[model samples]
Structures are given as structure tokens and as C-alpha cells.
Target: MKLSRATGTIATLALAVGLTAACGNGGADAGPAAPVSMDEEITLTFAWWGNDDRAARYEKAIDAFEEKYPNITVQTQFQSWDDYWTARSTEAAGSALPDVVQMDAGYVRQYGATGQLAELDGQVGVNLDTDGVDETALASGQIEGRTYAVPVSLNTQSIIYNATLLEELGMEPPADGYTWDDLVQWFADVAEAGAEHDPQVYPVGDMTGNNPWFLQWLVQQGKAPFTDDGQIAFTEEDVQAWADLWAPLRESQAFFPAKRAAQLEPKTGLNSAEVVAEANWDTLMPNYTAELGSDDLELMPIPTGDDGKKMYWHSGVMLSASASSAHPDAAAAFIDFMTNDPQVGEIFGTSKGVPATDAQKDAMTIEEGSPDARLLAYEDARADDVTEPAPVPVEGYGEIEVEMARLSEEMQYGNLDEDQFASQWFAYVQDTVKAE
Candidate 1:
């Protein structure tokens, strides 16, 4: 069921549209999408969250898009993750979001339900061709039977390790079918093996503070984080259980110290070589390899649970058009080009993530022993392991995730115990979700 919200957050747009129970053609009568005229020239504003490398890739893609459609011009801008949200939220308040924007699955429901995003189903057959896309990946962009965004790529959580470190310690990588207890023992082994090294090499980075990993843990336990209607399905006890899972690592100093982690701003144990392993998205292997200046990194899914391992395919990145934009058709056409163009696949490679469409995937040239090849090989081997459906984050999910991270940081600092963390997080969820 679609929900109506009365919160004053940017998602509501201050226009009192209140949250229309549905966002796309399935819920609201927003009329048909505006038609584009090939004869007339149009300019579109596009924005995204990323570093310079991603910006450069988007630039190339946009250039190709404009070359194909001479009448359409795209002006682009980008920012770091936090800044991107801040700027977009400000723009959302005035109903002035860019014509085209990079979207996160967590924020899609909030923006779509508030009338800030266009209903994309109207453009599907006309301007967008999804025939080459994965059905599961495409479905991830919909909520309440409405399509508000299009997934550009898909990814899943993985534990990436520095093979070089393992080699230096004369240790072998964790074998397949390793359980969570085995992983903890592995951390202890790494610590003991590297005890006499110049700079102490820890076993793993702290993943306890990451919201997505927590959700992944819940899913692995056969617990869905949210209901189909976008309400919280996990309870406070669930949160506590997640916290407890990592207590031994925290107590035994198996992970990189939180202080040291903070000192290495914008860098992580996997990237900086400060620790042997870290749990993150599989798509980040390239970045980690680049940062570590080594090609000896490896990746695998998180350790197994009682019933065996479970994971969900995630829409790593997505695109959405602003409902208030003057050039809806042009916006959608560009999105379609990005989604279906083989050249886009080549230009982006797996930098943005593994492409969501077969055409794009076919376009990639995965050289042997390359990071791209390894990432693809890993996914292919574990495709069947993804047994759960992708999550549809509830309204205010972005804010809730941020709060989760904050409380986790406090817990890391010894300011909040597991009980306090659960209580505070549930309280924040109540106010935030209730307000929405």
C-alpha cells in the first residue's frame, strides 16, 4: 500500500502535495509525460555524487549522448557524497532539482512519494528501452507499482582482502563456506601472525558502524529489513543482535582501531593497507586496488550463517528525472541512453558498477587477471547465493541510515553501549518515520 506523509523534509517539497500515496503512474494522475521535439534545442542540468574520476566518466558519456542528439545539451556538476545530498535537499525544498540526477535506492522512495520525481513508466516504451536490462535490477527502481527511477548498475556486499598482506604473513585466504565464527578466528590469526610487523596489521576494518552491512546481516538471518509498503520490519532487538555479533572483535582489538581509522580520513583499511580485510560492495575492488597500488586484492561474500549464506542484489546506482523539470522527455532520453548504450558501458566499465543491461555488459572487455574480470568472476560464481529480493527503503531511510552510522560511531567511541545504541536508534526511527 502507498503511504501519505506530512513531514516538512524536502521530500514533501513545501508545496503541501503531502506524500501522494503513490509516486508514478500507478498512484498519481500526473498526466502523461511531456513530449520532446527533435527540432527544438534543449539544455538539461545534471548532477551526481562522486569524485573526479566519476565526473570525468559522466562527462564522456554526456558528450556521446549530446553527439547523438544534436538538439540536446547537458550541463553537469558533481560533489562528494555528503555535499551532494545537502545540495539536492536544498534544491528539493524549492522544487528546483536538476533535470537529471543520480539517485540512491535509499532516497528514491522519499523523493518519489513527495512529487519531487517524475513518474517514469510513461517514458518506458516511448523513450526508454529496457529490453536488455535485468528484470530484477529494473524492478528495484519501483515502489508501490510505480517507476520513479531506473537502475544503472547492480552490486552486493563482499569482504575484500589484501592478498599481499596474507602472503606477507604466510597465511592462506579464508576457504569457501567459512562461517562467521571462522572469520572471527581468522582475524585473531592475522593479529597473531603480524604481531611483530613494523606497523601492526589488523585483521579487518570495523564494519559494525555501517548501516548497509547491518541490513545485510539481518537479511542473511531471514529477516527482511523493511516491509513491501516501506515500513520498518526489523525490531530494536534485531539491531542489538547485530551489535552483539561484533562484540568479540571490538573487545579483542581484532579490528583497526577507531582512532586510527578516523586519522585515515576518506581512506579505509582495505585501501590503505592498514588492515588485512574490509567488508564493502564488490564494485569497490577497483577503487581499493587503485588506492593500495597493488593487484593482489581478492573478494568473497560475507561469512555463512546458520542456514548458509544469503545475500540480495542491490541497485548500486540509479537515475531519476525531476518532476518539476521543463524537459522531461529530454531527461528520460538521456537516462535511456545511459542505460542502453554500449559505448556508455565501455566508457564507464565497472567504475560506476557492473552494468545492469546485457548490451552494456557485453560491451565490457574484461582482460584476464584484471579487477573487472575478478569482480565479474566472483559475481558469476555466487549469483545463486543472492536468494533474497532487493530492499525498498522506507521514506526517511536516508536520514535513518545517517543516524545509524552516528550512533555506531558513538558506540565505537565507548559512549554508547549496545543497549543504548538500540534504544537511541529506535527512538530516532520512531520520530523520523513517524514524521514522514
Candidate 2:
């Protein structure tokens, strides 16, 4: 499952359409005509994947959009992350897809290549404001040099830690610019401290099966995880070394056991305070703070490489229009409102990630001492050290993500040794990319 969930804040633009303010009232003097009026009333089905909390936020945004464009009624369909892709794939096969759909980078190429998604650029009756949007983030939504989607927000990887727990154990928190060796030693020390404090509290949460963590490590080693043409970039030896790096930590109980980690929700172990630290996206910091019921959580840059570059990327959820939609204009209008409107940003406020546009970011008022503020501050501090994002993954990349998790788990549980796991994983990746 794509673990990226909706969370973030931004500002809103003034309503551009000249529709009547008597939106929901069936009255004679309802309002003026919409800026871009349709010949007939049209209904569009907008779909997305998220939890209940995200659904509520989206509902509010959709309601506002409906009020602005009375002739365009949007029917919403949302589901949990696991069920979303299954339904979408099915819909695609039948040429039946929602008009506006929430998208992720991992699946964009796959969907776009199949002609299931509409090209946003040069599309009739669609006007997207690209003026102040982050170019890097906007570029992530493109395939073969044509825009197929618009990024809703931006996020990057970070190591979130329990500052309260570290202080309780009489350990200073790791500082920015910390090295991989520094992190390893700190985890080892935390494990040792557990004996005197609470042995049940491990130093780090389990990330042995996490693809993003593995990808970051590969980037830190100065290797692209995949080539521009979508070939596997690392060698079997590289995979073995990565597996070996975690072996000692697993043996020493520095990380939660594989079984226990698997049982927990993705990225929740740190929020629950079960482990002192975990690798996660910076966008999720707000969720962690809320779940933990404390403000002591802090975001740190992921460990850097020998060249001192932090291997970071612009990551977040995106929205796209379907090629088969009867209401392409309305779909594009809704996407424009969602991405460029300040009111939507105010309502969402870091639930999706940081706002992707400069206007929205400036208009946002992150509360003092809030998780959103902390995340934004961390980004500001590390702006210079951040590297260019990796190229968008190819069509079969989603399959590789699943394979990575399976292989990593096998290595963790002793089902496969380092060399065996490396060989197997490499071969599987080669086959997957080649098939694409």
C-alpha cells in the first residue's frame, strides 16, 4: 500500500467564478453565471483513497466547490488505501473511472501509459494555475513531458524521534548532520540503556521491510535506486551490505522484532512511543504528534552520505483527471480549486503535507508550538543540504515496492541469508523492469 496519506495546510484564492451566492437555495434570484458555464448540468464522480479523517476534509473542500459551481455536482467515492488501487485497476480495465481521482507518483506512469488519465496541459476548458507551484513537485506529476496530474502538497523523508524518551534515558538527542555511524551507535546505546530503564522500549522501530528507507540508504551511498530508463542501479553486493548493516541491530534487539513490527500499523510505532525513533515522511509529523498526545516529537534529517548531501525528494499525494470523464472541464476546475485555493489549505492545514504553491504557503498560519510549525522549520533549516529528487519511478515500480518489503522481511526473519536475499531481490527487480 502507498503509505502517503493526506495532511497539510495552504491558503485559498478568491473565488474566480461569478456564480450566485445563493448556492444551495432553490430561489428565483439565485446568482450570476459561472465564469466557465457548461451548456447542461453535469455530475462528476471524484474518487480518492484515505482514512476517515481525510475523507472529512475532502468532503468540506468538495462542498465548497459545489457551492461555487451550482451546475456541476460532484459525487465523491473514497475507500481505504488497500482497496483503492484494486477498484481503480478494475475501473480502468472497463474504461469506467472517476472524473477527478487522487493519485500517487508510483502509479501515475502505469495509469497514464494506458491512456486512462487525461493530459492536463492543453486540455480544452481546463485552466490550472502553475504560476507559483513548485516546479519540482509539479514536474513529478508529468509523464513523457506532458502534465497528467497536479501535486497537492510536498513531503520528504525524516527520522522522527521521541525526545521525551531520549531525555528520560539521560541521552541527548542526535543533532542535525548526524552520520549513519552516529545513528547506529545511538541506537546501540539506547538498547543498552533499555536494560536499566524499560527493556520493552526498543531503540528503533522496525524498518527492515520499508522500501523508502532502503531507497534513502541507496541514495546516501551515491547510487540511484533506478536508472533513468528504469533499470535497477545497485549491485547484488550493495544489497548484501544493506542487509548486513541491519543484522547486528536485529540480533541486539535494537529494533523491534519483525513479527511485532509487522503487527503494528505502518509508521505508528513511533507515535505510540513503542520505539524511540523511526524513519518516516516529514508530512506525517502532525499525525504523530496528535496520536502520541504530546509535542515532544521532533523531525531530524535522514543520515547523510560521505559527500554530506541529504538524499531527499519531493513526495506527496496528487490529483488527476480521467480521460474517459464526460465532465473534463468540471474535473479540471475542481482540481484547480483544490490546489490553488487558500480556504482549502486553511481547512486541510498539514493533513496532506505542506502546501505546494508559494501563495498557499504564505497564506498559511501555522499555530505556534504546533507539529506543522516544527515540520516547516525543519525544512527551512535543511533546505540547502537537500538534493534533487529521484526521477519518477517506472510503470512496474509499484510491484518492486511490494517485492522489496517481502525480500526485506525474509532477510529479517532468517528465511534468506544476505547473499541469497540479494541475489533473489536483484533477479526479481531485473525481471520486473524488463517486463515494463
Candidate 3:
């Protein structure tokens, strides 16, 4: 049976440490990992950030793990994206973090460099196995040379669309090799065709403030997004260019209305069916399916840029253990089971994204014509398009992106123009991304 506990508020003192605070030689020292073992009874605390569906999936997988190794019991808890980080930062201050955490690439540098996360390389052959995993995807969990986490799945940027709406309008998804200009024109076409519908549909959401898309755009133009020392590498001119790219859509109001979008809190345009298409990760198909109450959503490759197809496969999410865990052996063993087990792939399917290892991919039984099958096929079709290594974000990267998102919403609400948005964003970056 699964073990769980009620979530509680972290100490107010711990909250002052903020999300960027590093543990100062606390009990959770980063060194000398424990050897793998399951000889004695042990209980581990596991935490992740997600909705009810994801919680259920983890419970099912943990049930299998517990069945095999009855000696180890995992007590679990979870929170939303913002709350998860808040709690983690507080726990880090007290060196009381859960044994295992679901890590995001943006905060890996902050956690790993601060010694909050355990290096898993020592436990690889003994307990954790790396066989059949993609080298680049695995490397994303590392900083410099030490392995701090393991990627659970891989994802790439995709233009997700309402296939049912497109078919009803007799419209087609963007073709392969479609350019940025082509995408803009297609948006106009979609807006026109979808006008006569009962609920009314728009082309897409305005993603000009999206930081990842900005990085992709820079790479497509043969520019590096960050320096070796983790400082901002793009210019204010670059930011303005990105903002200007969507000027026509903003002017014509082709995007879903900002006021209307605000009402659909905790959901996106695609989730609420407010728009026909959106730029998002490929793994979101199942979530969209559940939200819209339809299995008609589909994924298409991101629009090609002037420099050709230069998209990179992102480590969608990762599993990492706390350095302070009393039961490191049990922690690593559970992580191994989650990452490499074929049964886990069947249980999770593409809800977390495509499995990161060949073993997990091969083990999953893809039902014909289902979202799981299409998700795998989508990744398989993009093998040649993944050219660059996934970008490892710098410390405070989370704050930077969150600020960008806030400013983008202001821009959409007519509080700031493109030039003002670029100016204010660069100013914030100056104060945010600093040397430690």
C-alpha cells in the first residue's frame, strides 16, 4: 500500500532564504555517496510537483516498486509549481528536504552547485543503471562533471493544434519545413476560417515573452544564448526583434484576447479551447486531451528558422535525491526503478513525455491510434531535427523567466510596447543574473 502524509507550511524563517539561497555546510554535505543496499527496512520521503493525474500515476508505479522490495516504503507529497519551489527552498535552508525531488533544468544549477543534491555517479553501476540512455539527455542532469540527477523523459518544442477543429474547418496543419513567416501567414488563415464557428477560435497565443522560444530563436540565428560563466549572451536588439515578430498579430488582435485568457487561470488557450494552436512541449498532448474532453489534439514540429532546423531535445523533468537523506541506498534504488523500469513506461506512457531510455521506450506498449502512439511517433520523426545540446540554465534562471512572463502579460494588456518591454526586461536581467 502507498504511504502519504498531509502537506504543511514550512517555517517562516526558512522562507526568508528564498529560492536562490544555498545551504551553508549544513548536514546535507555533498560528498561520499552511500553504497546501494536494501538489506534492512527503510522509509523514504519522495516529493514532486503536479496535478491529481500525475499523483495517481506515481502511486501506481510506487505500488509496483514496493511489491518487489517490500522492505522500502516511500512516503510521498506534492505541490504546484510555485509552491513546490517555495517549500524546497525552505527545506534546503533547514537541510530537511525530501529524499527525492522532481527537478527542473532551470534550477539544477542552483541546487546542485549549492550542495543540496547528491551526486549519483558513484551509485551508477552499483544501484542506478545508465544503460541505453541518451548521452545528451543524461548529461542535462549534470553540471560540469558530477551527476546530480537523471532525466525521466525528453521533449522538444511543438506546435500543438486542435485536430478536430482543423478538420471541421477543412484546414491543414503546418507543413514540414514551414518557416517563421509561413507560420504567421497560417495564423491569419486560421483566424479567418475559424471566425464563423459558434465559440470562435483564434490562430494562437502570443508567446513573445516565452524565454525558451527566445533562446531557440537566438540559436536559429547562429547565436549563443548564454556565456560559459552563465551570463546573458543576447542583446537588447535581439529581444526587440523577437517582440517585433509578433507585432502584426498583436495589432490585428489575432491572438486570443488577453482579458479572456486571464479568466482561465491555471489553464492555457489550448486547454480551454480558446485558440486553435499553441507553441508548447510535445508531452502536453494527454493533458490537453483530458482538459478538452477530446482525443483530437496533435503535435507538429516547430517552425523552421532562417538558419534551418536547430531545435534541441529538452530534459523535460528529472529525478534527484537529497544529499541529506539517511537512506541514500533506498533512495537511489527507487530512482533506478523509476528511470529504467519498463513497467513504469507502461504506467506513465507519455504523460511525463517520451521515456528517456531505450529500455523504457521499448517496454511501453503503444496502443494503435492513441495519444501514446502518436507521441512516440512524433519524437521518432524528429530525430534528425534535434541538432544542439539542451541548454543548462544558470542560477536564478527561474526568477528571470518568471519576470519575463509577467512583463509579457503587461505587454499583452497594453501597459508596455515592444520597445519598453525589451528595455525593462534587460534592466531586470542586470540585477537578477549576478556572480555568486
Evaluate residue 432 in candidate 1 and report its C-alpha lDDT on the 0 to 100 scale: 88
Arranged by TM-score with the best first, the candidates are 3, 1, 2
Could you tell me the TM-score of candidate 3? Answer: 0.88
For residues 1-436, write the lDDT of model 1, one tens digit per residue: 2122111333333232222112222123445655566777766777788988887888888879877887887766777889788878888876677778899988888888788888888888888877776666666778877888899988988888888888899998778878777877888888888776667788886657788888887877788888778788999888888788778877776777788888898888668887888888899998789888989789877876577668777888999988876667888899999999999999999988999887998898889899989999888887877777677889988888889888877888889888898889988988888898
State in Å the error of residue 368, model 2: 0.9
Clashing pairs in 3: none
Quote the lDDT for 434 in model 2.
82
State the displacement of the C-alpha of residue 55, model 2, in Å, after optimal TM-score superposition: 2.3
Which candidate model has the greater TM-score, 2 or 3?
A: 3
RMSD of each: 6.6, 8.5, 4.2
Q: Candidate 3 lDDT, tens digit per residue, 1-436?
A: 4334333345532332222124333123534455555576666677788999999989999989988888777767788989899889878777667778899877888888888888888778877887766776776788886788888888988888988888877799877888888888888888888887777888787878778888877878878787645677888898899899888888888888888888887788887887888888888887788888888899988877565688888888799988777666667888899999998988887778888887888888777988877888888998888787677777888778889889989999999999999999988887787644
Q: Which stretches of candidate 3 lie over 4 Å from their true place?
A: 1-35, 168-170, 195-199, 305-307
Between the candidate structures 2 and 3, which one is better when assessed by lDDT? 3
Summing lDDT over every window of 10 consecutive residues in candidate 2, give the lowest-scoring window. Answer: 9-18
* Cα lDDT tens digits for candidate 2, 1-436: 1122232211100010101111322111222213346556766667788888888888788778777777777766677777788878777775556667899988877887678887777542345666666566666777767788888888888888888888888887676678877778778898788657764677876465577777778877777776554457788788778777776787776776678776886646677777888788888878888888989798878776457575565648799987766556667788888888887887787788888775667668787878888988987777776665645677888888898788877767868866787788878878887887
